[model samples]
Target: MLYRPNPPISFTGAVLDRADHIRADADKLAELMNWRARLLRLDGLDPVIGDDGALVWGTLADAGEHDELVFLGLDESGRACFAPVSPANKGNPGPANPRLWGAMASLPAGDLATYGGARALVDWHARHRFCARCGYTTKLGKGGWQRKCVNMDCKAEHFPRVDPVTIMSVEWEGNLLLGRQPRFPAKRYSALAGFVEPGESIEEAVAREVHEEAGVRVRDVRYVACQPWPFPSSLMIGCHAYADDPAITIDKTELEDARWFTRDEVVYAMEALKTGAEDGAFIAPPPFAVAHHLLKWWIEQ
Candidate 1:
């Protein structure tokens, strides 16, 4: 599917992502430790507090010496900035929680994803302060990879999480199935989606979520693509499914309305928004949204 590339940072897994992986490693970043955790107050920068209640922008001092891989947060124009931390007057600047700064969801979407990972790590540390088994506070271990319980008797380790969900555009006859939740804005409908439960396959999730959310029976479910949705972290698995029938039964609790849209109508709604046409009546999601991707594929088909 082709559309304008969403800017700030393209989260799509592609050749460009190779650079991200190379940069994701914090080991190489330690080389900058001498410059890390400098008092931004001295530099005329007032540190901001993040959503997690931690003052943002601290040097990753805990990151060992001579490392060069530093994960950076970029602005809308792709200019990168050092996420600074607290304890500025001297000494090792206290670790500032960058995660707290990530809550400004209105920022550009690419920054949201980048800082979302940072915040997820910080949140993980704050929440896992203690071991579930021994109640002993844990320590950040393995270069922010794991949290090890401090109590020797009940040592426990925890890792970052990414919940997986299956989202699908169901097709039957010549119409594409779409649904609108009560919370959706007027004229907004999106693909049916639900988290993949333990022991459930992607195909199973597509079939199950379709039936549970819309009472529609799916015949064949095929995986298309996936996106990293980091609103507290979730991997959205996109798919296309064939519905067995055209009958609609609404799951009122989950969706306000469930129905089918002809490919022409989908195209009209999108093109209307694109060309500023007068008669275009439908409202689709933003270009960055997975719903837009699904619609792009549908219209192309």
Candidate 2:
């Protein structure tokens, strides 16, 4: 079976017999390996490896002997956490040696795609040194999985933060609504998404995002899958919603344009763009993206 990178496996959990013992005492393992340890900076994902060293990819359980490895932090619920490494890390120095700094928002996403978990987590820790409650300095603990507020009275325990977002493909008849953000590369467009607000459920967030971005009410919202969008920590909750209307009233401030396209058009765009399709045509985010996954699910349906 072709490995379908989906669900919990795509972001966390892997099938490995040995790695099940690794998590409880990761600090010891990492510390022991530190001397010969290839210190990897997965921040911003542009990795730089040393001369012909070993690198493990994916979760430790899914890892091979020669693959590069990284350590992501624990989830808020204290379960379901793992790192990511890919075939791309071969012969490349870890992220720290690469000196990558551009748009802050793009770093996490860009790094997760290119680098490993260490880079992304380290970057997250760097930005979250101050406590959200008392604005006091915090210190790393639990193998960098958490930070404790220095203030003894207000010692707030903070874990790596992940914003929950909902991105959906709204279908009406045989057409799907798609949109392009202002910051997206020219002619690039994908599914609509927005952050879940306080006191909101996932379905409500999906409906709200669709209405906010494209001015269309959505119904029959169904959970599809999720992607750990570690661009400084986001969990993208993917869904498929039925569009109640097709006419788009674009919120130009957020989206440059919004429109509906037939499945055939989407297929042609994806295929043509693969072999250098038309310049003015649309391009989807790579298949790894939840947007792409959602789009793929739409097309296949």
Candidate 3:
């Protein structure tokens, strides 16, 4: 069965038509890059919002001759949209202003989606400027969708990569498994997660990560929902399972703390989402995070 998350998800509902058909057609793409083309305004990966509380856009004229263009998609009016990635940000991004969160939260859904996709593509191009197979320099191709090696002998093409990660809620009796990494805010806890390694299915990854991090065995692994986390690009795969036993032996290398929370405790945090109440066992993740939605799905069960 397909997993559906309520309340929708951030970065999922993009309004642009990602006209892939034109990406490889140089002539067709050039035709779209006329005066009507729109350019997203980004400051070192952070968004630039207009006074109207929407993502600010400029024109192709703003692009510098050296700027590498990433085709975002076509806007509502079928006008082409693009983002010019500055080489200064290649493999390096600045720390966002603290208020970036608020700005992103206020953006319209479609705008947010456009920004996420554009950000991922631009960042990828910046970091992967060389052929992995031959150690030769590479240049943008396929309308920024791919990179081609300058060395004809090693013409390896590269594409944007989205690493798969497994984040899951494991249940025993009526309690849910939650953990806090060292970097997490104090008194905040969420689902256990780890990268999905090669040679494993989602079910295997969920089971393996839960065991490795919390020393707990799980069964009846199942899918829940997923989120596109574009912090350098990752796909957060959410899942649910039942614990064979609730005893947790924390892997300090991976987590600062791991424990089980009662259903009532999770219920309390969900309530805190609206009330801003901090007296609960631990602060639930923000509404936009897949972990928060996974907890919501858990309590509904």
Candidate 4:
């Protein structure tokens, strides 16, 4: 079944046709990069929004000879879309600059999704400049969809990778489990989450994270929804589970606090999404996060 939330998750509604087969066709890819092709305008890995709050685009004419162009995909009109690699922003660990977030907030969901994908793709290309296997300089290949080592004897190839993270709500006695990381804004509490480790299933990761972070055993883990979080590329797997014990022994190393919230408190926080309200039991996550939709789905149930 297709997991559809009331409103689609932030970066999952892209309208682009990611033509994967064309990446391997050198002649076809080159043909698509004509004067009609569009280039996404970016500022240090951030989007460059036009006055109308839409993603600003340019033509192939705007590109420099030295630029390394990444094929984003095909637009609705079948015109090719691309983004150039920026040296300064390639390996940047970003939640994005505060000002960029404001500009991004104004973007339409589709544009935001497109930009998120482009940002992640280009970032990966920039950071991975050497062959992991051979430690040789890597050159862009497959229309920037892959990296190939320059060493003749130790030829190697690499592709972009996304880390999987599990974010979940643990319910017990009708209360939802929420926690705050030290980096979160004051009073902000959202679903508990952690990266999925190797040799673990999603269900196991959810249960393990819950017990490790809050000392609460959870079972009956079920997927809720997911969001592509491009803070250097991560897929946030949203889920829900039942907790046998409400008791929380916060792992001070992982969280600043962990607690259960009543249905009334959660409803109050959900309503605050618009006004950016504080002074409640805790600040709820913004709509951009899958946590918000997961919590919203829980409320609907």
Each model's TM-score? 0.69, 0.71, 0.96, 0.96
Q: List candidate 3 segments past 4 Å from native.
A: 1-3, 92-99
By lDDT rank, best first, the candidates go 4, 3, 2, 1
- Reference-based lDDT, each prediction: 0.59, 0.63, 0.88, 0.88
Q: Candidate 3: minimum summed lDDT over ten consecutive residues — where?
A: 91-100
The backbone clash count of each candidate, in order, is 18, 18, 0, 0
- Residue lDDT tens for model 2, 259-291: 888888888777765677775357865555678
Span of 10 residues, lowest total lDDT, candidate 2? 96-105
Which digits, one per residue and each the tens of the lDDT, describe model 1 over residues 113-204? 44445444444444555677888877655445567787887778777567898989899987889888887767877888898999989999
Which candidate leads in lDDT?
4
Q: CA shift at 231, candidate 3, in angstroms?
A: 0.6
Residue 94 displacement in candidate 4 (angstroms): 3.9
- Worst 10-residue lDDT window for candidate 1 reads 38-47
Candidate 3: tens digits of C-alpha lDDT, residues 1-301: 5657654777788899999998999999999999999999998887898899999999999987889998887888999999987878764343324466686568887888888888888888888888999999999888889999999888899998888999999999999999999988789899999889989999999999999999999999998988887776878999999997888999999999998999999999989989999899999987777898899998887
